[model samples]
Target: MIVAFDFILLLFVIICAIAAISVKDLLSAVYILGAYSFFMCLLWAEMGAVDVAFTEASVSAGIGTVLLIAAVSKTKRRSKD
Candidate 1:
């Protein structure tokens, strides 16, 4: 395993997690969470856990993202804040 690559992915995962939580927009947060999931998938794949990577890609980054986006779309765009 490449240490530098792992660190890069870990950094991205942390950034995405922070961005997802800090963003006020629901859709943007969902997208960021999806990115976080993707980065986690990459990390798992790099660590030789292809099954985990596939599951993360199919579940979190895939269906979870779609569902979250659809739910967000159903909400009012403008927030009271």
Candidate 2:
């Protein structure tokens, strides 16, 4: 049961990672990347790596995301299209 759930979570994380890369919009991509990082943290926690998961959550999903959003907000929102 847990294996199946972890597999599904991994799949979703992969999808989010791909979406984050392929999306045209920057903010959407950043948010999707954050979600991907969060899912990774979840997987780590599930695998009994609470320390690693906490670090990932605090850095990638927390501070990194905030930095990205701040940087994005300082620049133009739309692409040249």
CA lDDT of every candidate: 0.89, 0.89
TM-score of each: 0.89, 0.87
Q: How accurate is candidate 1 locally (lDDT)?
A: 0.89
| Residue 76, model 2: Cα distance from true site in angstroms | 2.9
Candidate 2: tens digits of C-alpha lDDT, residues 4-79: 8799888998899889888888899889989999999999998889999999999989999999999899996666
User: Can you give the lDDT of residue 50 in candidate 1?
Assistant: 98
- Provide the lDDT at 5 for model 1: 100
- Write candidate 1's Cα lDDT for 1-81 as tens digits: 799999999999999999988887777888889999999999999999999999999998999999988888898644443
- Scanning candidate 2 in windows of ten residues, the lowest lDDT window is 72-81
Question: What's the lDDT for candidate 2?
Answer: 0.89
